[model samples]
Structures are given as structure tokens and as C-alpha cells.
Target: MHSKTYILISFHTAELGNPDIVFLISIVLAFTFIMFLTCEILLQGSLRDHSEPNDEYVIPHGDWFEIVSSPHYLAEIVIYAGLVVASGGTDLTIWLLFGFVVSNLVLAAAETHRWYLQKFESYPKKRLAIIPFAY
Candidate 1:
């Protein structure tokens, strides 16, 4: 992911000619750090509350789990979106990568949501697959 952002930066820099290196580096670093933190927080929250293998399956609660079936997947999409923004938001490749990530995660979240519905009749009817209030 960082590699792809670096490539986009290189392409953008080459086309624009002598863009501010410090500013670009700052943007990249900031986005990378945010992506790392967001993924850690959301994924960790999901995993921490997850049911143990021997335990009966239970729907997770708290954090973004209450809002969507797959908060971890949402984190992934956010990470890619941050990369796209860090890449100056004009690169075709980065946008395509973001689209790919979103599509795959959306599909996965939908499947997870379906599984939850099948497994537990008491699953919240208000919960969405991935996006909050919208799927």
C-alpha cells in the first residue's frame, strides 16, 4: 500500500515538476500513520470482542461493530482512501486500487452480514453490512 502511494507520488512529482518535497513527505507520513492507527484500533476492537472458538457464536457489540457487521473491513477501506488522498487524489492507479479495496470489502462484509443473519435470529435488524445507515 505504501509502495503504491510512493509510486503515485513519484508520478505526480514528475508531471508537476519540483513539487515541495517536505510537504509531500509530510502528507505521506501523516496518512500512513493515520492508516496504521485506524486499522489497529478498529481491528483490535473487533478481535478483542470476538467469540472464542470453543464458545458459542455471539454477535459482537461496542465500537463500530454496533453500527456495521464488518468494522475491520471499513478500516481497510479507510486506509486505502487515506493513501489515495496522500497520492494527491489524481492518480488513476490509486483510485482504481481504492475502488478494488472497497468492492472486495463490501462483498466480504455482505457475506459476513448474511452469515450473522443465518446464525442468529436475534441479530439486529438495523445493522448494515459495512457502511453505517447505508450499505
Candidate 2:
């Protein structure tokens, strides 16, 4: 009982000395750009019309919207995925965060997909709820 000691906290070391840092940084930056691009596309595609989805409801006709009901959500998952990959996936914390993001987004996307199908008979039949060609 006298030997009880507090656990010491260790800080994550900077990987700037490693060559892999360059590659990892590039990947992270690329995905960050992609995330912003997806957001812009969503804003561009949907914000123009004052009307909510109806019979004439124009779902974003091009790009990711053609593939999934929730491009924004997919983009978010991709962003986190990039972070996980950049961390070399040794960090369980990042993976747990990624899982949380995926679960929440999947649920939202699925609900949105259901609403889209119910509201519009012409909703792209081939499009997936979230993950393309799988979900």
C-alpha cells in the first residue's frame, strides 16, 4: 500500500524528423481540401432554391449527390478517415472518434435517404444511402 504511485502522462512526440511526415501531411491536407470542396458543392447545389423538396424537388443533380444522399456526411467521414490514416492508426482514440462520426452520420444519412425516397418517386434509384455501392 505504501508503494502506490500516480501514473505519469506522456506527451505525443512530434514526427517532424521522420520522412513519413511529408507523406502523412500531404494526405491530411488533401482530405482537408476535399472536405471543403464537398461542402462548397453542397452549398452550391442546394442553397439556390427557396423551396423544400417536393415533386419538383431538385436534389443536387451532379457530383457526389448523384452517388449518395449525404455527400456532406460522407465528406466528414472521409476527413476523419484521413486523420486516422495520418496518425498511422496506432491511436485508438482517433479510431474511436472516427467510429462515432461514422455511426452518427450513417444514421442521419439513412433517415434522409428514406425521406428522399418517400418524398420523390424519381429519387435516384441507383444512389446509396451513404457509402456508395455498399450501404
Candidate 3:
């Protein structure tokens, strides 16, 4: 592999100690996370005008929604995953928050996915409920 040179921004603090490789990796991962969030938001915004005030909005369709029932929830998980990495993945607080978030979103997506199937007979079978293939 061809390695590129980089700069380090370190602060030796008594409480938190010094920044290291994981922190830097997390910073890069943050960019990926924000992109996911931005896409999810913009996509949902495009669909919002077409799907409100009617009961039809319960079942999201088109784009990422076409593939998974709740893409925004997926995005939220990804954003939190980025944070988990940013925190070096050992923070119990972040892990618990991530767990709760995943659980809640999964439940909601399951309900929404069921609704989509019930509401639209033509809802894609290949598409998942949430969390891609696992869900």
C-alpha cells in the first residue's frame, strides 16, 4: 500500500491524555457519516412534499426508501456508529446510547415495514425493513 504523510493535532491533557490514531480515523469517518446524514435528509425532503397530510406517508417509497423502509433511521445508526468510532469504541455511554437507538429504530422500522406491506401490495419484496440485509 502507498502511504501518504499526514499531520498530527495532539493535546496532552491531564484528564483526557493525548490524541492518537483512532481519533484521527474517527475524524475521517465523520466526513463519511455527515455525507450519509446529508443524503438522507435531502432525499426525505424531496419526498416530503409528495407524501404528507395523507396516510400514504406512513409507507416511504422511492430511492433509499425504495430499498429500505426507513433510510433515515439507517442514517441515524451510521451517524452514531461514527461517534462510536470517534470515541474509540470503548465508551459504555456511547455504546448504550447506540444500542438504545438501534433498538428503537429497528422496532419502528419493523412496524413501518409491516405497514408498507399492508398498505401497498406492490411493495418490493427484495427490499428490506431496515439495516439492509440483516433486517
* Each prediction's TM-score versus the true structure: 0.68, 0.71, 0.70
What is the RMSD of candidate 2? 9.4
Cα lDDT tens digits for candidate 2, 30-85: 97777878778786866565555566556666677888888888888888888887
Number of the candidate with higher lDDT, 1 or 3: 1
lDDT (C-alpha, whole model) for all candidates: 0.80, 0.77, 0.71
Off by over 4 Å in 2: 1-18, 49-58
lDDT of 3 by residue, 67-134 (tens): 78778778877777777766766799999999999999899989988887888888788788887777
Candidate 3: residue 117 lDDT (0-100): 82
The lowest-lDDT stretch of 10 consecutive residues in candidate 2 is 4-13
Clashing pairs in 1: none
Query: Once superposed on the true structure, which residue ranges of model 3 sit more than 4 Å away at CA?
Result: 1-8, 12-24, 39-46, 49-59
> What does the lDDT come to for candidate 2?
0.77
Highest-scoring model, TM-score: 2
